[model samples]
Target: MDPRIDFLYLSEPDMIAAGVLDAKRCVEVCEETFALLGKGDYLMGGANHNNHGMNIVFPKETKFPNMPVAGPDRRFAAMPGYLGGRFDVCGNKWYGSNHANIEKGLPRSILTMMLNDKETGAPLALMSANLLSAARTGGVPGAAARHLVNKGAKVVSVVGCGPINKACFTAIMTQLEGVEKVVCFDLFLDKANEFARWVQGEYGVGAVGVDDTEAGFRDADVITVAASRLRPLYFEDEWIKQGATILVSGPFNTDESFLTSARIVYDHTALQEAYVEDAIASGNKEAYYSGVIGGPFFRLIDAGKLPALKDSTSLGDVVNGAKPGRADLKERVIFIACGMAVFDISWGFELLQNARARGIGQSLNLWERPHQG
Candidate 1:
């Protein structure tokens, strides 16, 4: 047998060429992945097998001069997983994030993805993951929006106007019909205005930039929050229109009344289970989920104000028809997305196939043969 180990290296442009920018297709791929997740056909890091990823968790203070202290969205994490159900591939996405990178002309979170063979553990592909991650991140909520958003939703509010939300907005646009207008909310009016211009040009929707946070919520049929970590967007229950669905992919802060009353859904229950356990283990029960979009919901659960995580319907189960989504038009629903590696591995697997079929990516040899075998 030819004992050569080879893998594909896909650069950013190559990934784009492989249709990574096809938001509609990415959403379909995410839908399939979620169904697989609902079937219990996936493996991720940690004993629970559903961890989002493991973080470096830098200390708040360090004696050593070279050691880094934690900053906003600053951490390194390795997110690994194996996805089954026609994918049957193993992979991981490496995440390095620091908000300071913006000053250096770099993205806050620099990411790369690796795919391996399930049986042999041999490398299959290594590719740039910024777009891949963004697409899948957006695709999850996009998938949720399909089953959760109220019909004839006309206005979409984006809470964060950064690149992540840009990708999310793109994916969401593919699912929502008759979205006549887009309202972008951001701390910087210029950034919001720029994003609004892009939305108007790209999606042909009426777009406006709003400095007021309430404008992002009122009269909007769907609101997607992807604001930076720890930077929570807050609003009153009265601000959210009846039947509005909040798709939270980043930090959010709101009243307990909203949490207690809304029709809450999650990307996947198991991952959040891991998150809750991890947070409890940290000994600071309330610190971790503080500003996170879904954190407060978990907090209420711990306080016994909400149902157990198992009782809440997962977006996956809804996608697979095992549970319900948006039962009534007036149901105020909130779908919290705690980022997961399965989406990255699964989507990367799909794109790797496309790269292979189209003869894209560079083939490189890992070794001529095994050293001892």
Candidate 2:
């Protein structure tokens, strides 16, 4: 065995230097990962091997005197998974989040990932995962954009112009051409305007802030919703034009007609089943899935409109050539991007491998010998 072992430390800047924000590459890596997922070469937590993992929730009222008070989006979670094919590795992303961080001018979530040795359960890299998480989160839909949307999708309406959506918008722009107009909508108009300027400056596309969400959706050939709203989705189906593709990266709401007619797709059916499992386990299906874009589909199944949950197709199948992405250009498709940890690991693994080859990131060595007898 080698006498010494060192893992690279990737700060945010190091991640940038290592091409962590390159959505184009992240999308490609995710494409491969999805292909593998379609082939059943992956394992996530839970009885179905597809669970999204258990999220730690906080109480509004704390019993412990010294415990921190609960706030919105304030919780901790551990997402663990393993990929099988060529990139046979296992790991987890652990993080604590607080929506109140914005009051302190900080991001809502602070995340980190540990790449592990498959056999020994040792960490290969303790790396910053903000960009890693953001890119993979955005890149999945960007890959969907490649397959689902029409060839000449000129207009893209961004429902949420936050950091994650920024990554999503940029990545879709890379694959799409003649995307001259970008319409943005956010509860905070200033953030939307700021996003507009950034998009215009970065991609040379025309960015405009629209007061009406429906107006933003009308002319858009592609729509991406990445807001942080927790309530039921209120976006009306009347707002979405025919022949448009909707990529939901955040929680959303839709009508019964749209839910029944539109082809409901998922990044992975198991991930959503994981949500159902969680709902059944916690007896809170209505609370968690009710307002979500996918929530309406579950409602339809309950209402006997759509088929069972198992009937939906996985995006990986579309990517792997087993199923078609857009059956016809006029078909309206709704893809709920329930993010998976394997995606982060898959792209993170590729980036780490690339960084090692290109000599990117800083390296630190652990102790030379074992501390315990």
Clash totals, every prediction? 0, 1
Local distance difference test scores for all models? 0.90, 0.82
TM-score of each: 0.97, 0.95
**Candidate 1 — worst ten consecutive residues by lDDT sum?**
285-294
For candidate 2, write residues 239-292 as lDDT tens digits: 777778889898877678887888777898878777777777767778766534
Q: Any idea how many clashes model 2 has? A: 1
Candidate 2 to native Cα RMSD, angstroms: 1.7
Model 1 lDDT tens row, 1-373: 7889999999999999999999999999999999998999999999999888888978999999999998987899999999999999999899899989999999888999999999989999999999999999999899999999987899999998998899888898898879898999998899999999999888888999988988888899999988865455688898888899999898777899988999999999888888888888888867867734568888888889999998888988998999999889999999999888889988898899999999999999999977897
Relative to the true structure, candidate 1 reaches a TM of 0.97
